[model samples]
Target: MEGALERSLRVFSGRGVLRTEYWDATIERFHLVSVPPDTAYQIGYTGTEPLWIGAWSSVGGDEITDESTLEPAARPEGNAEFDRIMATRSDRDLATSPGYDGEYDADPDEDRPEPVVTSFANTAAKLCPKAPEVGCNADRLAWIAELPELEWFSDSTVMKLDPGMYASTHTHFENEGPHEEIYWVMAGKARLITEYRDARLRRFDCAFFPTGNPHGIGNVGTETLWIGAWGARGGIEGDFDIANLDVADRPGQIEEYERVMAARKQRGLPLPPNADILDP
Candidate 1:
């Protein structure tokens, strides 16, 4: 009987038949196979069929050879050379304080004449409508990123507004966005009149406004007024049509608006009618 059973098993095994069981932990499936090497076979359960096959390597293991791989520890000198080249090509070298180049510095000084002026009109000419008088203008040494040679961020223009012995009124509108505007009274005193208040901003003093806020500046002091304005959002359009506001015709209205603003300030409430005073 034993000899007969051994012969029977040998006959079945010789016909490319051997039984082995495998548990796939990932899929939670058990597989039983009787197949030759490199041969595919299908197994089914509950009307679902899945193929099973034998591979030379285990599944989900690294297929790449170690000999063909790049080892960071083995290429110290090559990495150093690459680092040196990257540092040479970087803009870090230009990121420093103002340096002297005959007349201008990389950075600007309040006491000195502006090193550079970037015009917004010139920049806007490439984009949309133009505003020559009250567009973007700044007198500062800047690093224009677009034109690396020019040394500012954008193609915006800069203007030098001077209150020479008398106060002058100018309308301004921004197209790009709100800017961190500052009125650095370099030589004389000035008053900045926005949609809100008529505050006295003196020389060397600075004031800031959120983007899209419409405002204007006038030299209220008896001297040459120099102010510096620069911001990433300075290229925005003005929210209100400043040209339409007839300051001469609305003097009485402005006085009443000012009185209301004073009361709002005293009560610590939100800015009242002054907030939307320029909507019309």
Candidate 2:
């Protein structure tokens, strides 16, 4: 018989969750640089219900191996440190924090439940600068994982892609994958192409790629692209191509790809372009 995690991944393999609202999302933006375009990082959680949803994989400095299927990294010993940093925050504050918006508890008069807080600061700190930009591209990026808070459902992180960069095409179906991928576009533009579907994405859009599927995202415009992504296990998987990716990837990446395309067509804009054929 299959184990619990395996059972769950099998159940959620084909699902895709896209952001439906903008103003209602709980998102916090940050940066490591002290200059303009400090828009280098963002973290948010929008859970896809029913499934024990969560994330990992695709873009990171390190290649996540199948071992991730064993389970999330052991919780590091920085809960106290993270608690101290967040101690000033109350349940009310958590209710209003990024990732909790539009998700208020049923009874406002009832005492709000405290959010489960997990810290990956230990791991994050370990990936810090080895010397001012000498051997450290990872440090420039913001990352959060070991989110015990999400019940090992997923690990979340952000990727900052510059214009013209073509993300390596890969499937995160190995263990930590089998994850239904989710992308929240915080800034800029890109073309997301799967073997069957392709779409042009822009600011505030979002995208969903099923586990085990092959896809490529390339920044096709002139600005930096900040994508907030997550992976959760559960849902239907298939080969049908989803058209009209602009609305979804930028903020409205949605289930109705055709509807989104119609509006774009009415506006005289071209259909989403093909994925970049960059030299590997």
List lDDT for all candidates, in order.
0.30, 0.39
Q: Where does model 1 exceed 4 Å of error?
A: 1-175, 178-180, 234-280
- As a TM-score, model 1 comes out at 0.29
Tell me model 2's lDDT, rounded to 2 decimals: 0.39
Error of 1 at 97 (Å): 15
Q: Poorest 10 consecutive residues of model 2 by lDDT?
A: 32-41
Q: What RMSD, rounded to one decimal, does every model reach? A: 33.2, 18.1
1 in model 1: Cα distance from truth in Å? 82
Please give the lDDT score at residue 63 for candidate 2.
43
Show how many residue pairs clash in every candidate, following the order shown: 33, 22
Model 2 agreement with the true structure over 46-164: per-residue lDDT tens digits: 44543222323331223444443442223342232223223223333532333333433233332222222222233252122212111111223445442333332454555666666
